[model samples]
Target: MAADRLALALAVTIRHDGNGGVADDLTAPEGLTDWVRELAEPLRDALDAEDFTADTAALDAVRELRAAVRALFARAVRPGPPSSADAHRLLPEDQAMARLNAAAARAPGAPRLEWPDGGAPVVRAARPPGFTDADRLVAALARDAIGFLAGPERERLRACPAPRCVRYFVKDHPRQEWCKPSCGNRARVARHHRRHRTES
Candidate 1:
């Protein structure tokens, strides 16, 4: 259970990194993910007992899987779908899912997928000023809709009610109404105007 939670958090953070760049703490560093490296060693040991190899080919396979998982996570926080560039970046792996599935078939007691694949949907980042990053990110977001997430902190997933600020938030009470305190006061003033106007 701890492993599963860790994986979930790692996946979410990795997804936010979007090909890696140092930014807010919510993101990770560029290059091979440390969490992945940490998890890989243990995973390898466990799988090895089940006949998984430590051969060069196996190492490559694990890296590929790590990449796939990382890519899968990024779409969740990306503002838009992946662009053409993103598609091209992930093309090889896109072509390799069937193969990954085949390998998984060989493993004993496969992990439950929890979500329906519904097949990887085609996204176009090539029409009129296309960018693969957007398309890829969007596609990833769709996957997130069904993908495993650390049980959503419902209290932290509120949508701001301010007309000018439809932005999302990790914390906002329904009664809080607006995204910001100013917006909340604005609502109050609006209500006051409506009430006084009607009284007049």
Candidate 2:
């Protein structure tokens, strides 16, 4: 489920700023580098080393993949609206799938089995040698997104509808309606204001 978490993390790079606007955490090479480092534990397998640096190309590639992933996420939540920030600009579903698949193919990983002492055997996708850091990062993100879309977690995915909030999150419990507590509070406040306006 690490890959699933990673996929969700990548999708959430586009989020709501506290000031009622959209904010992107991966807007530049430095931002990408910081994000990778912040999620170093989940990204360790995808990166060649702990000090992985990003470049302009890497930033562009990641942004492209993010668009595709968000499109697919919108598809997954059919009958429900996607995040308001980019819902009007989602890529076509087929194009998004193709892009994700192509990115995942960049690294060309093979399945590797490992059996740790006193632990269960595990099978993981192992990237071949000689790929660039950008290739690895993009491939890892795409592969994780593919896995997440195909897995059971896809059923739990929801686009938070809180005012000015644009996020996709897995519903942890049956009653969960927002990505977090603050979002829920914001949503309630918005609803209350709407009701008061209608009455006035």
Candidate 3:
């Protein structure tokens, strides 16, 4: 994907507006455009050294790919009843499809995952390789994105308490505060304003 696509997509989803011009986390903390780059680097490095950025355009390209992969997985997990037609079966994708199918067939206890709407059967039965393939695909997404965090953050990455901006942040210690004090304070002020309006 194009550099801007990766960078913009991540920026939009992660919405780390604190720094928009330059990307960080994936490479030099100066190369990535979002926190995912930073989070993904360690795990991505484990997959391949060249899987990350070296310059501006390259950084954005992979960053966008990262965001795209997230969207893809989200699509896979959508709650809608499966279509009777097997609208999005993972088979026929490539060698991965064949491997995944065979693995599913071997598992005796696998759930027979089929379309909820009576579409073509997707998961005919529970398969052991289902998760492994998904994990591998996540790795592949990371590889394609050039970097990606290992998935959920180490700690419970919190969202800022501000009503207008729900930004995320890494809690440094047990005594740590909000994502940004100013934002937190602003939110408190807004709450107070609402209270006064009700009082009058």
> Number of the top candidate by lDDT?
2
Give lDDT: candidate 1, residue 35: 38
**Model 1 segments beyond 4 Å from truth?**
1-45, 48-53, 74-88, 92-96, 110-200
lDDT of each: 0.36, 0.88, 0.39
Top model number, TM-score: 2
**Comparison by TM-score, 2 against 3, better one:** 2
**For model 2, how does the per-residue alpha-carbon lDDT over 88-178 read when each residue is reduced to its tens digit?**
9999999999999999988877778989999999876676789988998899889889999999999999999888889999998999999
- TM-score per candidate, in order? 0.31, 0.91, 0.34
Rank order (by TM-score, best first): 2, 3, 1
Candidate 2, lDDT over the whole model:
0.88
Give stretches of model 2 more than 4 Å off: 1-4, 114-124
Better of 1 and 3 by TM-score: 3
> How displaced is residue 141 in candidate 1, in Å?
21
Q: Candidate 3, after superposition: displacement of residue 180 in Å? A: 1.5
Ranking by lDDT: 2, 3, 1
Better of 2 and 3 by lDDT: 2
